[model samples]
Target chain A: MTKVIAGASMSLDGFIAGPDETGFEHLFRWLGAGDVEVPTANPGHTLRMSAVDAEYLRDQWDNTGAIVVGRRLFDLTGGWGGAHPIGRPVVVVTHEAPTGWEDTPFTFVTDGVTSAIERAKALAGDRWVGVNGGTMARQCLEAGLLDTIGVDLVPVVFGKGVPLFGELANAPVLLGAPEVVVGSGVTHLRYDVLR
Target chain B: MTKVIAGASMSLDGFIAGPDETGFEHLFRWLGAGDVEVPTANPGHTLRMSAVDAEYLRDQWDNTGAIVVGRRLFDLTGGWGGAHPIGRPVVVVTHEAPTGWEDTPFTFVTDGVTSAIERAKALAGDRWVGVNGGTMARQCLEAGLLDTIGVDLVPVVFGKGVPLFGELANAPVLLGAPEVVVGSGVTHLRYDVLR
Candidate 1:
């Protein structure tokens, strides 16, 4: 079954992106660092992975079959320059589809997040439908369509910024015990959304 | 050498406590559950610790020799009923020392965070000087006196509340890669403060 999974690298203070939709370079510095052996449970054993950034990107891209993003992110990134990064079917949840981009790679769903997610699920088939952008992910979470949340928590604090979970209308969602993977400079946490 | 260490359990959205200084039962539900083996790095290895709450209380109390807390927290908790839970010397950073509390186990430091930390260090000797409450912790972080930060990140998210790191006067403090320990319902993260 296809699951709706969302992942983002956020600061220790919970800001996924800085104010004014700023780039996440500061929060994601650990990912670009070279490979380093991170300690785990077994005192005699260590797990080796690629650089933090590369591992996260490779895992998400490999596991995802489609992507859903918000209109603001679509505009901010200029629609991924007419080509989606992961080469997946991209659904943009917006009030109005952009003009003169019919040949582009993005599918704009203006109706609502539900319609966008439906389209994404259709495209995803048996793989995961990933959500990007805080607004779109929050919408999926609020609509109870998101099944998993993976956070790459970097060890930096943005005193203020765009909070990953903000302005939700439902009661707090309960999450199963998280699976934590300690990396070079980022700790990866995956949680299953409880119904 | 005495290290100034700060620890707090915060919501996924970065709130250390709820609004109006509300109780942390919601954010801390994981602590009450018992006897769960948390998975770690090694495939065959699992960490068996006490219940989340018990482990946190024990580790903090055992490792700490003295504590520094904000005046508001000191007042809110009624000075921990004239004695701190750790049974160590407590320094309360306030503008003026509370009357009649001089005879109590708490010490009110009107000078500043530095002075409070100094007094805590004197009492702590070679052990850890624990910083409690967000305001006092932020002050220690801003002063470059905090040597480590341990955060027990709960899976719950409060839409809004007292943020863990708020109103810092200095630039973002970089932290070393954290040691991640996944527990029953909480993920404990400890990071070294990069000088």
Candidate 2:
């Protein structure tokens, strides 16, 4: 079975992004905080992190066969310049698919999260379907389709900003004790969502 | 020199309490989740937890010589039924000091968190002074008076609730990588405030 996982690097105060989309430097400081290099799909772009974090990141990248993300993120990075860092097929959840970007690794779904997840699962097969944070993650979790939650918890307080899973419709969402991986500037916690 | 630390049992989503002040059972579940016995100030009150948690709790309680809390918490538990769990002097920060509580182990500070912390530090001598969550923690952090942050992070997400430190005035407050202690159902993280 293809596991559906939602993942994000969050501040200690539970914000993925600080107010007005600020504080990315603090949230993602671990990306360049160490000596071990973890390269993404983009040529010449690599993350220098601690050996512990490098290993964890490599494993996550290797296991993720496909991705489901919301439209906002798609536009934010200009669709990762057509290649996601995960180096996997991308399924984007959007109302209207963007123009002139066909015959590539990206698949835009016009319907809903359920359909997008279903398509991504088919694309992922036996590996895993990685969901981006914010809207995409919230929809998947609320719909009971998310299997695990991976939080790269950084040691910074953002006070107020975009939350991990914004305004969860059904919550008190309990999770099992996480498989913890302590890195240089981040503590990676992978928790299974309880049924 | 006495260290000032603010601590709380927080959800993974950064809530010190769930919506409507609910979900205490989940927040405090780790206290009763294991076999090792950890005794409180009250003779008859004992917590059962894994050896890991018991040792952590013991170290915390033993090192904390005094506590500072907001008036809200003082009234919430009726001043912990006259005896705090940590077996230390309690300083309550309020607008008006309540009457008839003069001879107890509690002190009321009418000025602010600064005065309350000063009193707690005096009472603590060479030991650590602990500050409670929410308003008290926020004030301490904003004023650059808190030295460390200790979070007993539980595996739960409350969609909306009282945050760990509500709306920090000066944010993007970076911290050192935490000293992580993994327990049965909780992860105790102690982080030093970066200058």
Kindly list the per-residue Cα lDDT of model 1 for residues B67-172, writing each as its tens digit.
9999898888787666775678888899988688766668888999999999999999888999988888888899899999989888876667888878567646
Name the DockQ score for candidate 1.
0.50
Which regions of candidate 2 fall more than 4 Å away from where they truly are?
A: none
RMSD of each: 7.5, 0.8
Candidate 1 runs further than 4 Å off: A21-23, A35-56, B35-57
Q: All models, DockQ values?
A: 0.50, 0.88
**lDDT for B51 (candidate 1):** 67
A70-173: candidate 2 lDDT, tens digit per residue:
99998998989879987899999999998888988999999999999999999998999999968888899899999999999999999999999967888899
Backbone steric clashes in candidate 2, count = 0
Name the top TM-score candidate. 2
lDDT of 1 by residue, A51-130 (tens): 65456566767788899999888888787666666778789998888788886668989899999999999988988999
